[model samples]
Target: MFFAVFLHVLAFAFLVVGRTLAPRNVPLLRRAVGDNSTSSGIASLALDKSSGSYYTVLKAGDSYFRVALDTGSSDLWLISSACTSSQCSKVPKYPLAYKSSTFQAVNNNQTEFSASYGDGTGVSGFVAREMVTVANITLKDQAVGVIDSSNVTLDSDVSGLLGLGFPRLSSMSESVTNSSPFFSQLAQQGKLEYPLFGLSLNRFDNGSLTLGAVDASVVRDVNQISWHPVVEFSPFGMESQESSYLQWVTPLAGFGTNGTTLSPNPSYPEITNNASLALLDVGLNGIYGPYSDVSRLFEAMDGARLVDSEGGLWAVPCDTKQNMTFTFGEQTIVLQPSDYFLGRTSGSPNLCISWPAAQSPSADGVDWHIGTPFLRTVYSVYSYGINNVEAPVIGFYPVTNSTTAQADEENLSSILTTVKFTPPNSLLATPTDTILPYTFNASVAAPTTGLVSTGLATSTYSPIFQAWTTVRSAIPTIAPSYAVFTDSSGAVVTSTPSIAAVTLGSPPGWTGPNGAGRSSPAPIVVTVAILFAALGQWIFCFIV
Candidate 1:
């Protein structure tokens, strides 16, 4: 009896140690793919073309909600059942207090939470702690915002947003309770094997979001991934006093069209090598950059001209074949014409709006906002670094080849041929309206503030503005203009018009029609140890 009890105790010890030491591998799932249909236990990402967003499933309490994946901001918020706002009514909401047994309001729901985005959308609510699960890994008592009010423009398909940015960017961190973001919570709880996550966003098919470690299957060549150190300062500029990095800002080595590089704006001389700073944001659908640089970028393309000087909207010939290149470190990622073209305007089927929109430095001090147009070209990995032991880095691996780009270009050309539009002989001259350069005032000790444009049509006489308004009227399902800004006071402001719907072609530099193939995850060491321990108990029983 004594020997048998001793053997049982020994087996239990081995099981406990094995389970604790084993790595946790969680898979992100595409919304189109069923929740139970993860491929080899790897997360799959899905793109919603209507909203121009990518999202994944997140489970809170007993219910699951689809949340948009945003790396630009740092906060995980969901509309609550208590919310009666029209925007909140459109999407799925978190369960009521009694509905979920695990839901607990922090500070008796007195602590307020608020955050905003570059696109002029914002959310405000109370803080709560609940068991949140992504892929299969669960973070117990994760702090999340129970949004009671919001001006965020969300489609019916997505419940809310899951921000994968740093802790300093989190509004919850600045709240009374001072809670960390969801990803940071996972690390603090020792749930991740590695302190990073990988994202694979595809235009044609399903993509993936791998937590803890890189997904070997999606990467064509791991060794080729060019990793860059994350910029330490706030991408929004020196206005804020946050002492840590906010967004996934990285160094942009070069940018040009058809091998001709554009000169960087001389106003910001702090950047090295005339290179601009780029924020890799998955939430934003298109690219935004300094007004001067963007103006030069469009000038290089045939029949391209600034359509709206104040709004920074540009138009180009639908049939233009210009190729743009963005260099980062030693890696140069190229984008074919099909990738940058948004689509033909409703009023003018021949004219197309360029995706690389221009923004004044006063609006957003960041030199560049690299969105899906650039991200879809390669596989991206974001490393948070292990508790300050390592520095945060953003790595990119090329998945698309020249052959794939050629095929995509041909496909776009075929579509454009059906629409009749005349090409301009020379580049149209820009408007005479002057846009002033951004200047930092060191005398005033205040947080950074700037006008966040809605990037939608306003009351303007420009033909492009009329065309944009016509398109918005044609699409009745599109949300109305709503501007929510996050400044020093955290005020929610209203704006007019949102982006008009555009026809989506194959994204610029996709690997193939179906994207990369999947591979089985490697065996865990803990599983092997457990099996060995169980076998030993059986052998000892037989010997006795």
Candidate 2:
């Protein structure tokens, strides 16, 4: 009888395991082949270590790590170590109540969540209540989501993240039972003015997030600036109900010599509507979207080229002219030469810089992205309070003399150069054993149909694991040359090596620094512009 019982148990285990292991393919893998079909959430934030320009932030618990905010996603999450659930254990985790006297968890039940990465990395974790604070606002007994894992590799130094965009791309909608995000809570309390908040991301070197009130010092006169109403939406479309996203008109008055790029021809050649709220963004990186008119404006004036990322193709160029200007509503502001910034890429061109462009998709007429690529041009402000209503609107102003723009790039270069990369221990050809112990009596098998299951399951896995061996085994890329500012006369002053100059397999036609000289006899010419608040309905940014 004992022998028979043992044999039966073995057969049951095989039956369960066979069902799950025998599925020919995974649905997540199939969906991943598409261009925009991805689960890795893109987000943005301000880098505190060096430049103040807002980038992206990633989150795990009570902690919020800065990352690149993205409009391409609909969910929000942070990597954490505290989350022991199989889902979250792969990424870094932060202890919810570690150091906060104000920390209190309204709910502490361990829940599982799964999210995909840009390189096809995915992790699952447990969710619970966490005490969190943003700026000076402390959230007590806040229902927080937690992921407890450290198996996934990170692209940069973001500890966690805060997602401040739209609701349609929210993780709360998927896993949490009864919880509202921080921004929504602020709106409920009527803590903001104009029922909105504004964002002002200065050039990458000198940017800062202006929440609630205007800095006043940066602008000529705050009272002279005209305010407008924010747009509203339901789900993915415009709705009858008032929206929480701040919408305002761009006042073009104070911009310097170059004048408003949108054109003053009364026809708004570049912009079909100046009343559009494309610039309203609080936690985003900078102005992003497909604006053909704006693209032509920059192409004609600054000589920028269009580029692409997960967000979409934006403008990128080798060099820029100084003293650029933009006007909003009744207010006009001018940006000096230094406000423009540059970027580097791992793919094609080793060095990628920001440029202005206008593009629209077939489904959406006017799609604008306020990302870091655009934010680095000016100082930004956000007022969570407006019209006795507490929504958020983004406001912009020029940034000067601050090291905000240069800092993020310099720091990013430093982090990448300094950190050492390590490969995972095991490389499996097919699906390997589960990292976490299986609790069910039978192995969970993959379904014959529908790659769609809401709950976190063993079947949900990242495809990046296949490439781990290839990437880890290869040698790191190195830059070949350095960039040195130069004058028309070709004299050198100061020089810095280019990251691309050292790395291999980087973008082609890599030019070290311009050979003219180490320094430009001309002063570092710059311009500064501002962008405002982003919507609370979507994922805002990502950590690099």
Candidate 3:
């Protein structure tokens, strides 16, 4: 009896110590399956071959909705059943709020949200609070926009967009005081073990969006990631009293081909000595840069020529072997010919459309929009800082090494048909003609290049021009959008926008900014306490 009583006293003492030692923000225990395996925190993503977009499932209330994961914007919007836009007919729509048991209207459904994108698409809807779930993390009373009208054209597979950008970019910021985005809510509620998330995007297989943790399956080494500070400045060309953190913008230290670094266009002298800023946008299918810079890049490749200046399309010889390189900080990422080359042009089998297209300078003064072509080759991690104590950073882990890229390029070359046609030097000049007309049949089989093929017969313009128009038109623009708000009474509402991680040079450990350790000891202490209590109960029974 005395021994049993002693055990109970010890158990009680342990429980008290455990409670006192527990962290104020206790992290969820890591799954036992693997350190980085898909737990409730990882959402699998499907790539749309046609549009080059990646989407994942978002659980809002009781319904499962397929939404694109867009880092370029900061609004969670879904097409409502009441939407009558022609574009809405092409995609899925969310059921009415009445259908959801957990749905609560924000401001009695008087708050309205509207946004316009760079792709000439826009959405206007009412804001509401709903229980939203992504992967395993659940955000109760999360702000969601139910679109009553929209012109956004999305892949048939996806119904909406889940913006993973900063809250300052949110369209509903003025309407809802608690307008934090889905990911932001996770941080605010201490759902993340770490304040960062990692993306592992695959070209052939389904990728994953890992929340609060890095995906270890794709990352060979933690040391592979080179971290860079996120650009914190006023939106390029916008006048503001103070600088603000906007998109996931980072510096592009250098760009080159075949070990030869290319100089920035002399016209944009700002980027001459300084590194050009690039927005790491997953929503964009291809890489876009200033016209002069893009022109210079293609000009370096053999038999390459500008096809459509307005659409920013270029034709390169199918047999070209030029390798592209991009530098971020001290790390350099290389893309072999197969990685950046699109499929062959229809009728003009000797030439192919390059994945790096041209675009005017972005409103944010960003020089480059690095999209799937660049992202697919690396594992990306975006750190929002731990409890707002650290500065934000973007880390890139090279998934494709030099040897792997070489093998893939060789395989691609083996499957491609050889061509002997030489492109005219005159075609390299940017065309000032009206946008050329081109059409693509949706039912054609994708070439071995894993890209859509053109079905051009013949046209007045060059065969390259005809093929490029269709290909360029198929690629959508996914830059950050402008926000506009309205009231439930259909009156326009105007408001001023209020402006709102990780350790560098450290190996692949749990250390974050300021050497804040990510490892948690609370679980260990709690487990010990539970075991002691269980043992004490057993001892008491044995004594009895």
The number of the candidate with the highest lDDT is 3
Worst ten in a row by lDDT for model 3? 535-544
Model 2: how far residue 503 lies from native, Å? 33
- What C-alpha lDDT, on a 0 to 100 scale, does residue 396 get in candidate 3? 89
TM-score of 1: 0.68
Clashing pairs in 1: 27-43, 28-43, 28-44, 30-44, 45-207, 120-484, 239-448, 481-497, 483-495
TM-score of each: 0.68, 0.47, 0.68
lDDT of 1 by residue, 1-544 (tens): 0001001121111101000011112233322122432111245555554334567666787655667787887788887767778876666566563346788778899899876644345678899898888866677778898888876656533567788888767778777353778876665444554456777875532467776556665564455666776765423344454334556877777777867866566334443234466888887666777777788787788777766555466777666667887877777888766666665544465577666767654322357778776788788988664332344678788766642235243455443322222234355455432334433332332221111121111212122112112221211011112234543566444432122221111112323432121212232112222333432110000110
Query: Model 1 — which ten-residue stretch has the worst lDDT?
Result: 11-20
- For candidate 3, the TM-score is 0.68
| Ranked candidates (lDDT, high to low) | 3, 1, 2
Worst 10 residues of 2 by lDDT: 17-26
Tell me how far the alpha carbon of residue 529 in candidate 1 is from the true structure, in angstroms, after superposition. 39
- Error of model 2, residue 57, in angstroms: 11
lDDT of 3 by residue, 1-544 (tens): 0001001121111101001111211112233123432223666665555455667666677555667777887778887767877776555466662356788888788798887654345679899888887765778899999888976655343568788887767768656887788876665555655546777775542567877666665665565567776765432233233344657887777777767777554222232225477888877656777776777787777777886555577887666667888888778888876667755555577676676777665444467778777888898988664321344578888876773235343455543433222334465456422222211221222121111111111111112112112222211111111235665677554422221011111223423332221222122112222323332110000000
